[model samples]
Target: MLLAPLALVAACGGGDKGTQEPPSTTAVLVDTLFTFPSQWSSPQLTLKAGGTVVFMFEGGIAHNAIFRLNPGNPPLAGAPADIPPTVNAVVRRTFATVGTFPVNCTIHPGMVSEVVVVP
Candidate 1:
């Protein structure tokens, strides 16, 4: 009985080991609007500036992300920041600007999501 207990403890590697931290960014699953009520997993996501938002799609109906920017919220610097129609793929977008971005999937009307980036 003593040997079995000791073996169990050893197997667990009992020690003050530092725990690993989770990744900074989180993924949002894109679902079919026809079957599901919503498009993105989360309707709205708020994160600090520089944080990344990952959109993951798993086959089936296609989808995309189009950001609606206005004078108050200018377009993202560099290349067009819209995620093209994609399926069974993962797309990542980093929010460096501090503003509210309204995203929608043109493929499916009323399929909308929002992301707010704060300082």
Candidate 2:
């Protein structure tokens, strides 16, 4: 009788809960040399908190990157300080806060993209 009740309890989730799965990592390609000189392949990226971003730069021009800071939101750090448009330049960043991080090319005009982090 006790064993039956114990079995029922065990089946009713009466134990320590398992750890929730972490958010999945994401990848964004910054190969605008082929698509358009002033645009990235994916203009908008959405990710969860602690999510990973893999920036793959495929170009032949000299281009750098920067995050356009908004006065009302937290800043996003860890972008590539220098991404010379010499073939394939890769930048990996992890967004810690939940906000919109707008991207722009420092050397090129109108090279804009955005990364949205959500919790």
Candidate 3:
């Protein structure tokens, strides 16, 4: 009887030894040259603390996406420095802070997007 219980415990533990949790996934697609459709587009992105944002380029005419500080904030002066642009490429960034950030395309000046990171 003792062996039966030990065998049951061993069987339960052995079944989970090689099992792994699934990886987290997030995909945001940019469509067209400078226009992002609602299906895969986001006006504002909300990311969990330490969460990642995956920007996927769908059908587009070689556009770039860049992150920058909001110029409207009064605390800082001078134009905000542009983060390196991701042109026709999938970009992933992990946000560690909770704040609002402005993003735009360097190639297409009018194409803009926003990212909102939350704790």
Candidate 4:
């Protein structure tokens, strides 16, 4: 009797777990001067207007991400604060405004990437 009840419960709990949504993606950044030739894990990333992106700084290296204020990219209303020079830091930013955001590392020259937000 117990085996039959257990079998019924297991059958009732059967559903395709593959239909679930995948885990959120994140970007990893490291100091190019010491780690890799390029600092960015990806040159560019696109996200929805309300989506969030996580930036992971590799350990044992001083790295910071600053949103550059240039001609096209003045300032974003919902941009994350500039990441300070840290050995290992994790920053999350929500893209509320739809625009192209340019990120750079002040410690390393030629280290740059862009994040595009769409509607």
Candidate 5:
């Protein structure tokens, strides 16, 4: 739990407070950029305990998004699987736990960020 908070839904878009959705169904987008601030979605993502995260590779180069135990360390004990590399690719992942989650681009090292999920 290094950072994504899904515990990771998007700041805006989708779901209702109490109508029929728990807000956990909301989706957030993190663009894979090749420059500074690699992840333009947010340095810190705040998501509901059962929210979703959409990793959008909208940058020039190919990129992959993965939820890691320790940034770039691959395959944690309990975490979402890694998103493969591709340009203009879209990955939608849902988190069922309430904790901090870390996301990184497998192809592009040093592109790291965190998401926080609140109860």
Candidate 6:
């Protein structure tokens, strides 16, 4: 009867929350040679905590994406043991913690970028 319809409505409305929102995605374009545009030309990125940042290289000269392990710490001259030699091609790195990470190129030295994770 009418009670049955009301019960069904209540059950549907009070049931577990709808599917959680999907994690946001951020893109960093790596251009040819020693440059990655300061900002997005199209489809600007909005990063959040625990988000994924993808470095899409577009005909670059074997560029790399190396992030500083520690922001407060000073930059070291040589490469750290943990960081791989390079991060060429499409590279995806997740930011679980919230902070500003300084990224740079190992081969070109001048090329640099950053991944800022907000909580």
Tens-digit lDDT string for candidate 5 (1-119): 73565435564446665575445544333323232335545565776666677766675667776778554375654457777776766667766667777877756667777666666
| Clash pairs detected, candidate 1 | none
Model 3 residue runs over 4 Å out of place are: 1-40, 69-88
Report clash pairs, candidate 5: 3-101, 3-115, 4-101, 4-115, 5-8, 5-115, 5-116, 5-117, 7-49
lDDT of all predictions, in order shown?
Answer: 0.65, 0.59, 0.52, 0.65, 0.62, 0.49
TM-score of 6: 0.47
Task: Name the better of 3 and 5 by lDDT.
Answer: 5
Per-residue alpha-carbon lDDT of candidate 1 for residues 49-108, written as tens digits (9 for 90 to 100): 766777776556688777874323655552138877877777777777777877777777
Angstrom error of the Cα, residue 36, model 1: value is 5.6
Displacement of residue 18 (Cα, Å) in model 1 is 36
Query: Model 4 off-target regions past 4 Å?
Result: 1-38, 70-78
**lDDT of candidate 2 over 3-119, digit per residue (tens):** 999998878764445764434554322222222466766788877766656666665655555665432334356432333343456666666667777766756677777777767
Clashes of 4: 0
Report the alpha-carbon TM-score of model 5 versus the true structure: 0.59
Q: Write the candidate numbers in order of decreasing TM-score.
A: 4, 1, 5, 2, 3, 6
Error of 3 at 95 (Å): 0.8
What's the C-alpha lDDT at position 31 in model 4? 22
Q: Per-residue lDDT for 14-95 in model 3, tens only?
A: 4454564333333222222233532336566655555566667556545545566433444222213343534456666555
User: Lowest-scoring 10 consecutive residues by lDDT in candidate 3?
Assistant: 24-33
Worst 10-residue lDDT window for candidate 6 reads: 26-35
